[model samples]
Each structure stands twice: as structure tokens, then as C-alpha cells.
Target: QVTLLQTVVGAHDLFDVTVQLQPGGGIFQTFVRGSGDDFSVVVPDVTRVNKYGRSADCTSNNEIRPLCYCKSNLMPTSSPSSASKSTK
Candidate 1:
């Protein structure tokens, strides 16, 4: 099974996210900003990486190069209070 091993948040105002995959060897990274929307990344044979807004999905792939699926929802501003609540 694939798992999210590590993640790093960016310093800039822009949302920069990086995720490390486990069980195999794959890395997924992305940046998000502006209106709320979804974005997808298709690697097409290695593995599928799904990124939602500032969140990232990194998973290992058994195949040579699988398709990556990334979805994101951008917002005008990020609310720290709301984020904290979700963590709990």
C-alpha cells in the first residue's frame, strides 16, 4: 500500500506543497493559488498523485510509469483557525 511519509509547507504566500511516497519510490509536489478549483496530475504509468488545494498525495507504483491524478481547490486566503480545527 502507498502512504504519505512526509510533507513540507512553503514560506511564500503562494501555496507550495511537497509530499513523499512510501512503500516504493515516488514524490509528488505542487503549488496552488487563486480561485477555488481542482487540478489533476497524470504521470501515465509510474503512479497517480492527487493534490487537493494545499494537500498532496504521494504513492508508490508497481508499474513503470502510471497516471497521476491531482485535484485542487484554491481559495483567496488560508485560514489558520479553520486549519487548526480540522487537525483535531
Candidate 2:
């Protein structure tokens, strides 16, 4: 199963987020920088790594590159007073 690992308020309206897939799963290191509704996602491997987003790899007889990234739309949601978000 995939789980959210960390969330830290950063400077310049940026937030650091980390997600880990359990039991030998892919680890996603993502960054979200924004406030309120709209946010930007920063996936460093978005270019090189194929996660079925931005770039993709489908299995076939001619070419077979397994998907190495996990897709789970998880975000932090709670009062700032509590540590609802888990951290690494």
C-alpha cells in the first residue's frame, strides 16, 4: 500500500512532501509549492522516470519497461495545530 510520509512548511510558499510505497515499492519524493487552492508539483524524475504521467512505459513484446512510479493523489488536510501529516 502507498502512504504519505512527510509534510513540512517551507519558505516562499513552498511545501516539502514525501510519499513512500510500502514493502518494496517505489518512493516518491515530491515538492508542492503554493498556497490556497492552486499548487505546482515538482517531480524531478518526471522526465527520466516513467510513471504513466508526463512520461510513460507500456509493456509489449518489442519493448517492456515496467512502471516504476506510484500514483496516489494524497495531500495534507487538517488543522495546523495538529500533526495530521506523517513525517519521515
Candidate 3:
């Protein structure tokens, strides 16, 4: 969960965000600046991002689920060759 601290009007919309981490009960605050579809972290630089992988089968309330990728998601849902042999 995050709370909006302040918003500044300029060329781009600048705002302060305070992130309240669940489970561990920690706090992370940062400045996010962007306009329209573009946005980025401006200070502290503590955020970690996962760039590659498949979608994770995580619960809706999991905070980091959006950034997670599970190896199980890479596995095929079913094998066509195996299914054919079994049917025969």
C-alpha cells in the first residue's frame, strides 16, 4: 500500500510516494516522475525489477506478484505426443 505525499505541477507530473510493505512491515519511499504513459523512479534507487520470465500464478493480494515469474509457468500445459500415445 502507498500513500500520496505531495504532487508538483511542472513539465511533467511529479509526485512523492510512500510504499508500505506488507508481511515484513517495512517502509520504502521514493519520488515518481512522469507524464502520460512514461514514468520512472527518481531517487534512492532501491527498487528491483525482473525483466524476463513467465507470468506467475500468484494470489491477487500479493504485492510482488506483479513482478514475479514462475518456472512452472514455462512448462507446457499438456504434451501432444504423450496425449496421443495415451489415447492409443
At residue 26, candidate 2 shows an lDDT of: 43
**lDDT of every model, 2 decimals:** 0.41, 0.44, 0.59
Per-residue alpha-carbon lDDT of candidate 1 for residues 1-88, written as tens digits (9 for 90 to 100): 3234232255333444445554233465555433347533322223246422223234344242333332322224659998899899
RMSD of 3: 10.6
TM-scores for all candidates? 0.25, 0.35, 0.41
Rank candidates, lDDT, best first.
Answer: 3, 2, 1
Residue-by-residue lDDT tens digits, candidate 3, 55-84: 545445456654455656655677898989
**Steric clash pairs (candidate 2):** none
* Residue 68 error, candidate 2, Å: 1.7
lDDT of 2 by residue, 1-88 (tens): 3244245644666655555544224445566767789888755442212143322222333232233322222334567556545442
By TM-score: ranked, best first: 3, 2, 1
Pick the winner on TM-score between candidates 2 and 3: 3
